[model samples]
Target: MIPITMIPRSEVQKIEKPGWVLVFGRRKTGKTYMLRHMVRHENYFFVTRGGLILEHEEQLLYPVFEERIKNLLLKDITVVVDEFQRLPEKFLDLLHYHSPDSRAKLILVGSSFSVARKLMERRSPLLGIVRPVKVGLIRPVDLIRGLFKLGISPELLLRIAPYIRDPWIMRFVNPGKFRRSDVIEAIRFNVPALIGEVFSEEDRVLTDRYELIIRALSLGNSTPGEVAGYISGFIERGLRSQDVKSYLANLLRMGIASRTQLAGRKRYLYSIESPLIDLFYYLDTKLGYYEIDVPMEELENLASVKEGTYFERFVVDLIASLYGARVQRSLDPEIDGILVKKGRIVAAIEVKMGDIAREEIIKFLERAPKEGEKIVVAREGPSLEGVSLLTHRDILSMAMNFEQRF
Candidate 1:
């Protein structure tokens, strides 16, 4: 077996809860990793895309696999099915049949839309018994704690957070020999294949259009109109804003894209959910790096130049998750994110990727929501009048407090 360092996730707390369960997420988010390490099961089966099943030491056809599940479940054994989405439609019935009356605990792990729809939608047979837990990219607090345990400083973790929280991305990182270039190199080398794996988790239709849409978002074409306009330049007969909207909706459902309400407006601004993906496509759009060879040094420089955009997005996601807030976007330039808690706008956050100018922080403080919180997240900053300045040290403290509370 290959040696690997597994990052502990807070999702395991949810996954360890009693009873039958369904865990789902976008591909490459480490659904299988968490299942294999954090949860306990007597039998683990892997269902392949071609409907073949691998159990302990044997490969079985669907009928044989179904029979095995029946036998084990009858004995009340804990069974985990990885890539459960690839199983036949009748698999749900098989689950519904044994799960209710038997003490057999079942864990079904999958990443596709079908698994989600069948198990989460209103009519699902297992809906009542199976608890659905979505395991996204590692939670920032969990990641912060994980890094701290590994003897990495909070200062370094802030730099690492944007690149490594995806779990799979950490494979390329050497914690002791940390460097920004290492993370950039990981993206340059791995993202194309990573995205292909993400696509495989979906039904894989209109692939070219999907790629163009992601590329468009990376190019800052965030609105439906902007996305349609950008994609139209490549295809014949053009596409309407509505045409791109459905595709965006699909991406959103698949957990590949995310959107936030444009504050005080019905419209929303969309972006790729994973900043790593955004940066990958952004680099591709800017340099055609995906199509031709670019020297690793050149790629690193280019990634550094555009780091602020993706870093700000990462901060917004991280802070929102930390504070139990929803992300709100605005046309306002001074603020990077408007955080909402319980439907009320709670804070305006400024994410600084470089030296913070005294005047810049003042400008943001003056424009930030006056009532709640004005947070400046940066490496370091002047205490400045009364605006709350937060560094990774503060964040690490928060994560520790959060962990203690929960």
Candidate 2:
């Protein structure tokens, strides 16, 4: 297991008082990893869904409580329940029952939104007793800095860092500047050929062809029809509307795609978490489908297109890290970002991939009501009238480094 720090040790130190904490994040975001790391210093009781599930809720929970409080007569014991929502709802009362009497601490961790929603619903036993904390992707800088400390050569870091979306994964690889063909070759081997690995095997196929379709949409096919057409033509597979929607929905939840409506046209934006995925989707053919129609050379050439959407997703993730709760995506005129702090507009940003045009800047600015601060992000440094130009890197860095001003 690769250790990536999401919350600093100092932050955990501040939570000395006994209370309920609900830590959550998307799948594979290292929530349980950090929780286990934190509990090592204390006499902690770890309970999971599988351990507590039974037809009789109380019977399942009573044993857990008895075991947790067993032989601990010192300072308050900490109880960490991963996937707490999966436990019977009645278990919430059990948690509330022992805390005041034994002075024990409870930490509930859940990964699925469905679980979170059930726990947060009104009249739910866990409602109002939990403080929600969302864990997100590890920052690129933190991953890079940690890798350097771990004896990974910086020379390799700069080379492979840009390709990996998960900074923790990328910085660990620490290869040199990757050629498009080289990375695609890696994808051709890594993306599985079995549908079971990529999707539910009973229903899906692990066709690299589907991944290529997702890549095509991410690159620039914002509309559903257009994206569907691109995928069908590229793979020569007759695609359906439901297929597109289901696949896209999965991608959005994974933080790999985003969607919004503008003038009745729903635009789906790609959140490229891994540049390697991007390169694989764009360049590699052998990995996606059961069979290949495009020549290997042509596929490699296809991946060579300048990727702007990949950087856009990076910006979104960076901003999400900084302003997790304060940010909202705007629907009017398709602006890339809208930030509100303390009920006031703080910053509005839109990312343009290349060639900052004055008219385009004006069009984007018009989406905002001219409140607070506004900035435009682009690949090239351009001096535009009435607009501040920010490099893609600078914008991403600022989002990661943003501090709440309210």
Candidate 3:
């Protein structure tokens, strides 16, 4: 087994505080791992799908567990409940009842945001008592450091880093032994299983429409109007831009898609947030939905496109993550990435699959913020005046360097 390094998350400090913490994020973002690292074995309780049955260790049924916890002398004890959403409604009610006066700190780890929201809604018994901490994908810097520690070369790390953003997927990525087939199998089976559960259980009403919108966005239909146009072709009725907007809003809320706006531009561009979702959509389309077999040539073509797109997005997100920047999109010159900080443009970036030329750099610089930094990230690029040039290896090194400092 490859030993995994734990990335230092700021939220771990918050978990140490004395209050109810509702940890919310998508599955496999390390919610359980972080909790297990911080909370003692005796203090933690994991609620499985088998309901409240007590198993090995200190597992307990809700009724008996509730009585035991309530009767225990209040000390510095921290009670951690993993998959707290799976517990019965009464168990949550008990937590709500005890939250105000209970001496023990309660840490409830939930995989589904919708379920967590329901428990913490205004009318719910836990309202105003729980502090929400969202566990996002591990930072790029930390992920690079961990993979390097596991013997993955920087080159291989850059190659696979884009697709395996979720740490759960990293377990399957063995540097020398990994292959594209492994990625396809992982996406084919895991993406639907994880994302499907969230949509079916939480957003069941418009799940079909949600999938359609995400598919459209994954296919490069970035604008709201473009996505609406693409989706309208299949549905019975013509989709109004407003209706499409509403669906996009829902996607954003569920963390499936993200919206970006240019610095001074009002138009918003939508993109699928999860790399797994993007890969699934790409392969699903290339293989012809519901079809089992995919031609090798077509698969290669899809992989090429996936690599290009993922690399561009990775570079943009890496820069944003490093500098605490907000990514934006602009038309008319079609800049690839815009970084903003404190409402001011800090950098303009262009990501390319091939080498960038002097003229191309000059063109991008012309459209970029005059006083801000201009960057061109490509597979191969010659040095140009008045621009920062970065290759994929350079990016990996930059992220690794940041991790060392952290």
Q: Compare the candidates by TM-score and give the number of the best one.
A: 1
lDDT of each residue in 126-198, candidate 2, tens digit only: 7877776665455554444443444433334333434543433432332433344555554564543321332
lDDT of 3 at 15: 66
**Tens digits of per-residue lDDT for model 1, 241-314:** 99999999988888878888987679999988787888888888888887788787887787777567766877
TM-score, structure 2 vs. true: 0.59
lDDT of 3 by residue, 1-406 (tens): 2334444554676666657788888776778877787544347777878766343466677778777767542655777777877777887677667666777777788877797778667898888888888877666665666566656555566667676566667666565666776676667777777777667546455466777888888788887889889888888886778888988877776767877885587778888887767878877865763358776566756767777777777778888888788988777778888899998888889988677787888888888778588889877777877788988678777876773221
Q: Scored by Cα lDDT, where does model 3 land?
A: 0.73
Per-candidate Cα lDDT values, in order, are 0.79, 0.54, 0.73
Give RMSD to native, each candidate.
2.5, 7.4, 2.9
Off by over 4 Å in 3: 1-14, 37-42, 53-59, 71-73, 151-153, 203-207, 403-406
Ranking by TM-score: 1, 3, 2
Assess candidate 1 and give its TM-score to the true structure. 0.91
**Superposed Cα deviation of residue 329, candidate 1 (Å):** 2.0
